[model samples]
Target: MKKSRYIILLPLFISLTIPVVFALTSKGQMLENFKRQEKEMIFESQTIFLDEGDRNILKTYNKLNVYSSIGDKIQSKREYLEVQNEKINSRVNSLESSIIQFDKDIEELVIEVNKINEQVVSTKDEIDTNKKTIDILQSRIEESTVILLEYIVYLYKKGDYVTTDNDIDNIKSILLSGEKIDELVNDLYFKSIIQLTGQQLIEKHRDFVSRLYVKKLELQESENQLKTLRKQGILERNILDDKRSSKQRILEITKGQEELYQKYISEQLELERDIKVKELKEQIKLNNTKKKLLEKYNCEFVDIQVQQTEFSALDEQCANINKIIFAESRLSGIPLENNPLDWPVNPSLGISSYFNDTGYQRLFGTDHDAIDIMIPMRTEIRAPMDGYVVFIQPVVNTGYAYFAVKHSDGLVSLYGHVNQIDVKLYDFVKKGDVIGLTGGEYGTNGAGLLSTGPHLHFVVYDEEEYNDPLNYLNLSYLSYKSLPSKYQFKYKSDFKSRKGFEYADTSKKQSTSGSTFVIEGENELERQKYLLGTYAVGDFRNWDIWVEESIAGGIDPTFMMCVGLAETSLGKYLKSAYNIGNVGNNDRGDTKDFPNARSAIAAMTSTFNNKYLGKYNTINQLSRYGNKTGAIYASSDFNWHNNITKCMSHVKGEYIPDDYNYRISIK
Candidate 1:
């Protein structure tokens, strides 16, 4: 069980100690030093108390009813912090239990090592006694050997023993004569006694020598056993030291983690407090602002016309209209009869919220007064009609920039959530004139209050009351879907004809005989394939035929593909009838449809080759003329050539120029 616990902690030990080892010393001595440090340091249980003030702050803010998203975010953060704190506490508890177990293990190992030490000392004492006995036995054996040698010498001198045959015969003849029988008997008895004594002494000496050798062997074994016990004791002590070190290291790390978690929890609580306070203050400000806006709307405005002297003092600026290209939609759906106002932005960009949209009441705390036109940040906000700039908020980063245009019809158009404005107050702007860039991305300048995402809030007011801007401008079928069902209108296939742009006559057939098209780079075909695959242009998955045909027709294949992108988003918005480029779209909204993507591509390339490529071979050259595919092909669209050029640069892996001006000469 103890070993299993150590095994479980092995990974933690390595993880905690290895980094310290690397930070302080070389790899060779890192582990050794860590072990030493851990063993030497004393460890105590760490108790980290939660800060009451931090807890109270969180509890106080959490109790208050905050309906804003910020409040919800703070609550979520608090919950996450709580979870983290609980996890930390759990881990600390586990580490403390592990440390306690290690302490117990260390104590056990210490006792075992001491017992081994006692056994080792006892074994050493036995070995010493055995050595002393072996030495005494050796001395006794030497003395016995000397006594036995003296006895042998005395027997030889007394002639009590004989080995020669002549001496034995003489002794026999003397016994027969019976002259010294008694003396012989006496000598024999004394010699036998002396021989017995010597034999006993030799046997005793052999026994002592054998016992001495046995003692010496036993002493060697005892010394070896003592050494083994000492080694075991040392091993136990090492284990005890390792356990102590492990416990100390765990305690130290747990203490540090506890402190860090406490600090983090405190900081999170403080942050929550600050956020709640800020939200409360902003709520008050927003209520006041809303009240003031309501009062302002209720009152009548006196027109303050700017004199020539005052107008000349401010900078006169105009908005850039070419930055945006309106997507294809039914223009006839919009009501334009006797309407001075036009669309402030492309209707196809869609609307997020409408006037008095109840969906917005929860966020704004009131009925939405204006329509929210959904568009990306920095999109150009255009003048809907010929109007004079009546009010302009020029602050760029205060989130309060907006401008109002007073139209001749006594209607006012207010554009809000604007970051950049070009025109000064009292400046006259015609319809479709660019005014400024729209904003509303969160935390960005001009996002103002209650911005969920990027969009333009467009408001209109008559002298009497606030009016829905949708009532004044033409609405497309696409944007019509974004409004409440009451404002939506049924569509008719036979819609009115659209307005047209100036164009040169195309009554005569154009020839492609003079056209000479060139591909841009050596690797352009492969590059175009990669770009098409990257954009997942499905129509061009089998695009080799389209590219070959386009190249054979003396037009850049990339430009042809770009034309496809410009018209249909590379076939995403292609009409179901399979006209990839909307090839023959005109003012009446009629389009030529092919049977397949390849046929469409071929027809588009051929049309470009015959009509436009004969004069303008390159995209730059084609775009150089007024926005009508060099004033011949698709002569109504102002953004056609620009879009194609942009796509050409993009697909060819060239820099897409930000400048939308297509009039500049290409180098």
Candidate 2:
């Protein structure tokens, strides 16, 4: 605490200079001008905000900055990134589908080409075998023809004698005449068996040549097919390369956009700081003037200290915060506005404890500074006034989440024990707009601060002092508009939960408790919980919580979702097993369990990014892999790629689930 001063003495040099300035200075012209300007600035602020109007006015006036909270800037930047990423992702997926199809086609062509190669090899081998058979037959036929002719000639020479003599068994007698004849007969009967006629040998040779010619034609046809396939593969690959470059360009452009948003945020922050500094300077000037007035009033008293010094002494002489203005009544500021503040929560204030209530007094060291409005979890908490949210503190070390809104005239409203904050820090919110939801009471896990039950801890502070909320609220307008049980009102309301798509069919999955709907949310972890039903059956605990998170590292959401669905059955874990790629199978004759989904998904996507990012543009390329056997993904399941593609369609809302038969009233 600062010590109170009764009087002050001016230093000798200070008093000399003060007399000089009083004689020579204009009659408060500068001071009056300053006061007028400050009052005018305040008046102008009430009617207009510099940020909402021409933002470029800051540059005109040399302000050099705009005022926006860093948190709000980050959030705004993030939303931009999300929307942009969504657009880029859509294009990428479209192009990638084509690329993947091309790959599949190319793979089929390769198989065809390989088959043609096999046929060509086989045909060439057959042609060679046929030629050798033709050569052997021709050699045998020529030798036999020559021997027959020689025998015929020899017979002619001797025919007159042999035939005229009418020799018995002339052929057998000729063979017995020499060992050569016997050898020829023995060879023909043994190894040769039945020698083919000369005409038969000639016909067989022609048939082999004809077969070889036909095979050569077939080989030429296969070679032509191979050439066509190679050309097509090259064309498809070139197209795929262009698509890949397009995606990369999109990524780079998105990165630059994010930087632009960040730069704008930085400028806004700097402007905010400058405005704050300027305001502080003005306030200090006004305070120092007030001190001079206070010192003049001190002369009215007869304290020795007051008699010892001049009225316009500086702090060096008086050592006082304010020289003479000490009474609380002299420090009255602007009065509250006539309009009443809106109720901060859906629940009425009468049902809960008021500020400084008997129970509140004992629970805390002093009477409660704020009213406690008891409301159920996830209830919409609204702002009492149009103000900018200046703070958001997430839960930390067993603490609950809380946020603060800075209103006009230094009035700040703080909300505690909240969850799922809808407004980011520095977000300008209108009256009755959602700021956050009520949290569980002080001691409840995740309730934020000290709470007794699911309720909102609302406090209104002016600068540093706390004010009773009842003072600002109009009881007539905001009294408890409820009957008996809060649950009946909470559950029966028509507030619909968010769905993934506009035409999403979630009726079949709807429940009376409003928990079973598997759909999207404001973020990823929420989506995982909804998809896996970790809140329902806990078949294999929460899995797939890392899908969107992996996207930050360049993983595609559709690819991840499809793989997760196909591999782990949307993390249903029916087999009580967990595998990100759905590839790992336990050897225990049963399904296995994983500790968490995040690490598993990380490991899986990391491997994928490493293996297929630049090399492949489609999931089919991942399925029928060409690396080492162990390195190949989904090789065992021939339909792995197809199943994943189908799942992707489902995730894209192009394929509705068969069980989505239930209906709900769309709001």
Lowest summed lDDT across 10 adjacent residues in model 1 is found at 321-330
- lDDT for model 1 comes to 0.55
The parts of candidate 2 lying over 4 Å away from their true place are: 1-339, 349-351, 396-398, 441-445, 478-667
Which lDDT value does model 2 have at 363? 45
Q: All candidates' TM-scores?
A: 0.26, 0.23
Tell me the whole-model lDDT of each prediction, alpha carbons only: 0.55, 0.48
Model 1 C-alpha lDDT per residue in residues 342-407, reported as the tens digit of each score: 778775777889887645653444566688888888888898876666555554454445777755
Superposed Cα deviation of residue 203, candidate 2 (Å): 99
Residue 358 accuracy (lDDT) in model 1: 48
TM-score of 1: 0.26
Model 2, C-alpha of 419: deviation from truth (Å): 1.7
Error of 2 at 517 (Å): 52
Error of 2 at 3 (Å): 40
